[model samples]
Target: MSILVDKNTRLLVQGITGNEGDFHTRQMVAYGTKVVAGVTPGKGGEWVLNGKIPVFDSIRLAVNARGANVSVIFVPARFAADAMFESADAGIPLIVCITEGIPVQDMMRVRNYLDQKGVRLVGPNCPGLLTPGEAKVGIIPGDIAIPGNVGVVSRSGTLTYEILYALKQENMGVSTCVGIGGDPVNGTNFVDCLEMFEEDPNTEQVVLIGEIGGSEEEKAAEFIADRMTKPIAGFIAGQTAPPGKRMGHAGAIIEGGSGLAADKIGALEMAGVQVAQHPEEIPGMLK
Candidate 1:
């Protein structure tokens, strides 16, 4: 069984009328996810995407009327934290924040509030999570993935796609692939997803696609070294990124010598995880 979502997951799209919202919402609905309702504040009385799903004014109304337990936020960055808190207050069990550009301070505050309220958050600036051949919660390219025994967790969106493509080239498929977001302060971390994968019966091996960022990877290595029973292969991106400058990922910045690619690679290697020097080498390491 997959963690977080399954065939029974009922989803709600916040900002379902926006370009990003409408596009991914249609894809998700077509992929067999139960998108029960949507929310767009003043656009409550209006319909979205040919009126396929009902749109409401707030998370409270959406959850109250449609039993929406999971929410995917496509709202803009400035309002993402507010959306998250709204979902939390509405008692939504799972909230995926797909919006990018949310300030770090705002994320910290939101995270703290979520922790206090016991809410599960997936991303702040992420591609989102997918249970292959099942429900998808974010913006990941669903076409590239197929359901199988391998589980994947990544920080970078495009890099997750690259790793999945590589695995597919090797005739391997994924049980689940989670883009846990590239934000410094996110709801789920590598270790959190790893624990979920470890308990998932369908997953045989795991792939961690990370990038130069906070000490999250290093912390995950320590956790894996001590607790994980599954074989893990890892690849850290941004090897060529200039120091102190953010790479393609918002969280991929080197500060105080902490978030260097080499450092994360070393930590993973020391934890007995196979480290892929190049992205292409990941599938080989997994095999």
Candidate 2:
């Protein structure tokens, strides 16, 4: 019923011994994500979360021994990209990197490698994706999401949470929610998530949570105009963003008439998308 993951997903954590990794790994397990294995390099053979999960030294070992189909990275910023590469090379089909602050150049290389290897990479600086009641792969709080028909793709972490909460308030549960990160060069974008949602029969509609920076919203608008058949409710953050000021990220900086809230809003409206002015308005738009 989800885009990228489901109950059959064999999950593993790459930095499972670290504080963030250890905590979320247990959370994911408790949420019934089928967390089968974990990787912590030198801390192989150690048990995390009271010996319920087995840890390995490398992703290859986790995949080979435990059949880890998906790898979620909670490594530090400097090693996040390498962790992603290791996952792909180890034959994991889906890689989700929850680590923030990874260098853009490193992501660029990871993207290239992923393209060649035909792997799906979710985020380097994101909250990650969830399939609602079926499965959760990253740091998104599992309790807030319910099983439903709406699909969500967002760039901002806090904004994603807000929109999801609004949807839940309306009793509209999501089929999938993907946080594609706010970085300029991330593994996935709005377009990629849109295509997947469009093809998923469980997803009846979509909500795009975009920000003020980057032409991603414009590009997503173009894709929706030309290809998508599902109804989409779109929201672009940073309406109050200062002009000539970068509201959110390096990629969010407004310059030379690009990445403006007005322009993105205009594009989405032109492409037949219903635009929400605020998070509270998003649930109404989806209806």
Candidate 3:
């Protein structure tokens, strides 16, 4: 079974009227995700996708009327935090925030609020999650995946796609693919996804795609060494990145000699995980 989403997921777009929201909403629907409704303040009583989805002014209204158990945010970064707060207040069990560049200060508060409210958040700058042949949420392309037993978690959306495509090329597939995002202070982390995959009976193998950043990979390594029983293959990006120079992701930087790709790779190897030298090598290790 998938960890965060599946066939039962009823999703609502928080900023459905905007361009990014509009485009991805169509893509999700085409992938067969049960997009129940959308939320756009002051655009209530409107319809989109050929009048298939109804838009409400607030998340509470959408949740009340359409039973939107999951909410995905597409609003601007400045408004992204508020969107998450609204989703939690509306009792949305899971919230996915796709907006990037949200201030770290705002996310600190939002993270605490979500923890207090017992809400699960995916990303503030992410590609989203996908359960192959079941549900699609966020920006992850669905065509590259197939229904199977491998579970994937990643800090990079582009690398996530590359791995999935590579797995598909080998006729392997995934039970779930979660892009946890590459932000310094976003919701969800490697350990959280690993715990979920460890408990999922449908997931026979797990693939972890990490990068040089915070100590998240180290934490996940510890968890895998101690508690995980599933066969795990992993890859860490940014090996050649210079210290103190930020990479493509805002969170991918080395400072004070910590958060190095080499360190992360060593930790995973110590945990008995078959760490790949490159993204394309991941699928072979899993097999």
Q: Which stretches of candidate 3 lie over 4 Å from their true place?
A: none
- Give candidate 2's whole-model lDDT: 0.89
lDDT of 2 by residue, 54-155 (tens): 999999988888998888999999888889888898889989988888888998899999999999998878899899988899999998878999999998
For candidate 1, list the clashing residue pairs, or say none: none
TM-score of every candidate relative to the true structure: 0.97, 0.97, 0.99
Clashes of 1: 0
Number of the predicted model whose lDDT against the real structure is largest: 3
Number of clashing pairs per prediction, in order: 0, 0, 0
Q: Name the better of 1 and 3 by lDDT.
A: 3
**Residue 125 miss distance in model 1 (angstroms):** 0.9
lDDT of each: 0.88, 0.89, 0.93
Order the candidate numbers by lDDT, best to worst: 3, 2, 1
Minimal lDDT window, size 10, model 2: 246-255
